[model samples]
Target: MTADTAVLPTLLTALRLPSIARNWKRIAEIADRDDWPAARLLATLLEIEVADRTSRRIQRHRDQSGLPAGKTFATFDFNVATGVRKNHLLALGTGDGWIETGDNLLIFGESGTGKSHAVAAIGDALIDAGRRVLFTRTTDMVQRLQSARRDLALAATLDKLDKYDLIILDDLSYVRKDQAETSVLFELISHRYERHSIAITANQPFSAWGDVFPDPAMTVASIDRLVHHATIIEMNGESYRKRVAVARVKGKDSASDN
Candidate 1:
């Protein structure tokens, strides 16, 4: 109740102890009620602050990652993605220092085969583990990079992307063979080579990548850099979306017959 006590929160705010500043009053009351020692009270306050800060940091990163909030490993139907190995993905989800070493992940599958969902789930897991990530469709990211080039700020844009530990480029097959866009996309791939991690989902295999990049040589170069230290996951299975649609139609037909 003293004037000095009123200024305590202000001091905590200035020191960037936001959690402690907001909850110290209530926590102090609980500590006093339990007759806790000074050390215990201080430790409890710090623990609260650390937990709150960690939660907030994860939330911020997740928000900035551009990943779908509902797309997580828990919701992913592994049975449909039979080609995906659970243990391998679990290991990668830990963000186990592999990104720091600049390893890449190549997810290959046909349309509706859950390639995008799989990589997004991994990105979500990485975000939960305190690693930065960005999720963008292949065309969208390439266009942004292309715009950056026209504005003569491509390097600055790439530098901004470097802030992320991993960049999830969803649907690599969607990027057209536009020389400008493909060049920027290749630049991004080349720039991140052996320096950062990339999780790419593609419908076509490496041999058919010529459709994505106008120049055959650039396509080869991009593929080489991406697969140098990469984990290749082949998800070539029946499309889960098609399977579900077929099941739904069957159920409707059965109901009509009944």
Candidate 2:
């Protein structure tokens, strides 16, 4: 029995995280009496369980290019736990319990209304619940689609969107998409419409989607499908970055006086 073999049982009990505890063998190998850095790093890494969980999330979205590393709705103020529900904003978007039933959703708000964060949090929750999720910016997705097309895998790539439980397109309208890209995007949205779920964070309103897709008909079709069984969440607030900047400035001034 090696030293790790001896403490494996106890270490498992320490964190009470069975999934992480399973890594005891490796953790023990690097945990030497003098290697505090290595030991602490390993411990902290496993303790968060992010190492294990994030991989699963990434794998799920690898097909659809799902959620970001650790985004979730729980991190924001409008969490369902204590959020104010105003379907008026999302009325056109929400389609009969879709939000609660893993259907599509769209969050359109000006800079810093917590729109992206809220949806990201939801994506995180989906991951935690063992649901497939992928998060990417519109520009990133279009680029990815373009790459897949070059490899002659565009159809395969769009189909993958159906595999994911949820997909989040963050910051749409960053740039215009060509006809082919818009076609693939439309297919992707149509595939997820009423079938899977999607959450989009856009700085620009839907009225301006035409700028992204020069084809007027395609844009309307895509939006129609996306909003059909979806919920639209509109948030209007000051920039979060600006608020943080103000707070930091106040702290600096206070320090100078002391």
Candidate 3:
């Protein structure tokens, strides 16, 4: 209500401290009522501003990440996906050192075995931990890269992607064995090798990747680079979707009988 208080908002806006600008008045009332020290009040405001900025940054990263919603680790069923260790994933979720060192994460499993969900969950964790991540279908990313190549902007596009701490390519096996498409994919893998992290979900083993990369030699090189410094997780189990479908049918039958 004072002249000084009326000018506080404008000053905060000029300083670009939106969080502090918005909450400072309410917090100051609490500080005064509680008889807090000057240092405590200042520290509290700074902490609120930092936390608000961090939340906004994470939200922005999540929006740009293209990650599927509701696929976070909290919702993942570790019991069904028995091959994946909860402890190991929890450790990886921290993204403590591997992401910094550009280590790759390769997940291999059959369709509907929760590979995509698992990786997406890990990606979500990395984002929460202040790491930037991009989630895209393997084929979609390859098509974009191919277009970039044709436009003579392939290098620039790759350079732009380097900003992300990790790129999650879902369903590697779905990419057709076309030379052009596969060539662009190979180029992406080669470019990011040892420079950035890539987390890939695949339905096929390395031996079957010859069908993904038309050139056997290219396949070999790609595999070598990906596995050189990677944590390979093999998810082997019945399809989660299949089980859910069966359960739905049983529930319907039981309801009809009742």
Task: Please give the RMSD to the true structure for each candidate, in Å.
Answer: 1.6, 9.9, 1.2
Off by over 4 Å in 3: none
Better of 1 and 2 by TM-score: 1
Candidate 2 lDDT by residue in tens digits, 92-164: 2223355445566778777766766677666665554556667888777877887888899978887866666
lDDT-based ranking? 3, 1, 2
Candidate 1 local lDDT, residue 229: 93
Q: Between candidates 1 and 3, which one is better according to lDDT?
A: 3
| Model 2 poorest ten-residue lDDT run | 86-95
lDDT of 2 at 27: 55
| C-alpha lDDT of residue 17 in model 2 | 61
List runs of model 1 lying over 4 Å from the truth.
179-181
Top model by TM-score, which number?
3
Return the top candidate by lDDT: 3
C-alpha-based local distance difference test score of model 3: 0.93
lDDT of 1 by residue, 14-111 (tens): 99999998889998899889999999999999999999999999999999999977888898888778688877887888878588898999999899
lDDT score of residue 44 within candidate 1: 91
- Candidate 2: list runs displaced more than 4 Å: 1-70, 78-102, 178-180
lDDT (0-100) at residue 169 of candidate 1? Answer: 92
